[model samples]
Target: MLVPKRNWLQQAGFLTGLYGQYLKVYLKTLVEYRADTLIALVAGIVAQGSTLLFLTVIFQKIPKLADWSFYELVFLFGLAATGKSINQAFFNAPFSLTGYIRRGQMDIMMIRPVGVLLQAIGSSQELNGVGQLVTGIAIMGFAGAHLDLQWTAGTLLYVVIALLSSAVIQFAVLLTISVLTFWVQEVRSVIYPVNWLYDFTRYPLEIFHPLLRGLLTYVIPYALGSFFPAAFLLRPESYGWAMWGVPAAAVITMSLAYCLWTFGIRRYSSVAG
Candidate 1:
């Protein structure tokens, strides 16, 4: 008996439906642990709030840092926060790959019919990210109003595209790191340094030395996800390349990450063996 192959649209719809089922399970778990979810949400808000407080203190002492005003810095932070939150909310389960591998869970996932990466992504959701998502939007609105940003239709569309690309970039970086667990088995220390690099995106890249600027722009490229997009919006004449660079970087990075993930999975061995 021959089974007909599904087209791209049908495949996409099937994947979407599968992911929706996973989300339902996650939601039920959240409902069962409402107190824990609430605590996590508050903790997330306070964690991000402390960073905002630090920025407020800095701006009070100086009119601008690296020629970026306080509101401009806030805009950059908000963009990065939103991107990180989206990644955490949807694609954060890879962080637990080490545990899955250690417990022989990866073996089970491999036997499943769905894509391994898709299963990893849909296995969990970080509800705390909802707090950061709300805070990021509020901060962006506040800073944009203060900066007197002209929110034309084109500007709005660009912002939406920029944020989604930014999220893809972050997810690519983290997923690439998590995929390393197939060989190394432990990556918490490595993950922390990469996360610390994200803090640099909250400020203007111009404040750093040329080497550091190059590191962010070409090496890690986290700044491209958050700082560049915000900078282009704030001063389009100054950072014109950012309009195209950010999306291009997202596509390139994600393609490379997915390739790495595929290679890792192919070589992965079962722990029981």
Candidate 2:
């Protein structure tokens, strides 16, 4: 039996390699601005930690949200924070699409031989998100020690996969929302509410009204990225399906997001045209 070899180029592997190189460049540039980077890092820490503190304060009063104990909800918040930090550090440029479009810089990107979508996504990286990463991991550790997760080997592996998949799903959704700038010209206004939706994932989705829960699960799928993963980790007997759906949802959302981004770029009317 003869099997055809996989075509790496056909799968955009080369473009991803270029994206990695761009990330290296972005990191270098970020390091070059040491003072600003320090300030940004501190600001990111304060901003993300303040949100966590706020959640903790609220949970202190209520003790739980829809059956999720405080420590369990901390795990959920950490999962969402990890995804957000990873996206910010890796694909922040895609979320800044409006600025490029407004300045007519996209034509330069379009002229490059590489894939424009990859170029756009890897154009910038928020090195400051290191703080958020630290905060998230710290919170996860705290919850693990306090929440009685009783994690077996398999469960621990599932948690790692679920967190990674959640990050991929988050990045995909942000990319899809940001890519709309190609047609909309300016998307800053829309991005605010979108940010709020992403922020919502930081809490237990079960706390939402049934209608909103159904909408998130069936339509937005944000719950899959944060709430479901947490529910699986903290209450596996009840939310067992999330152990499977985390990767499944990530694959589906990321595949669709890439397709839309490619289609959008194909429709791009360069600034000159």
Number of clashing pairs per prediction, in order:
0, 0
119-189: candidate 2 lDDT, tens digit per residue: 66787677777768777777788888998777689877987787778778777877788888878866767
Give the lDDT of residue 202 in candidate 2. 79
lDDT for each residue of candidate 1 in 1-273, tens digit (9 for 90 to 100): 454478999989999999999989888877898998787778777977898999999989999998888898999998888888887787787677787788888899988877888888887578887778878888898889999789999899989888888878888888889888878858988886886788788888888899988988887888888999999999999889988888999999999999999999999878886
* lDDT score, candidate 1: 0.85
For candidate 2, give the lDDT.
0.77
**Model 1 steric clash total:** 0
Give the Cα error of residue 243 in candidate 1, in Å.
1.9
The model with the greatest TM-score is 1
The per-model lDDT (C-alpha) reads 0.85, 0.77
Q: What RMSD does model 1 have?
A: 2.0
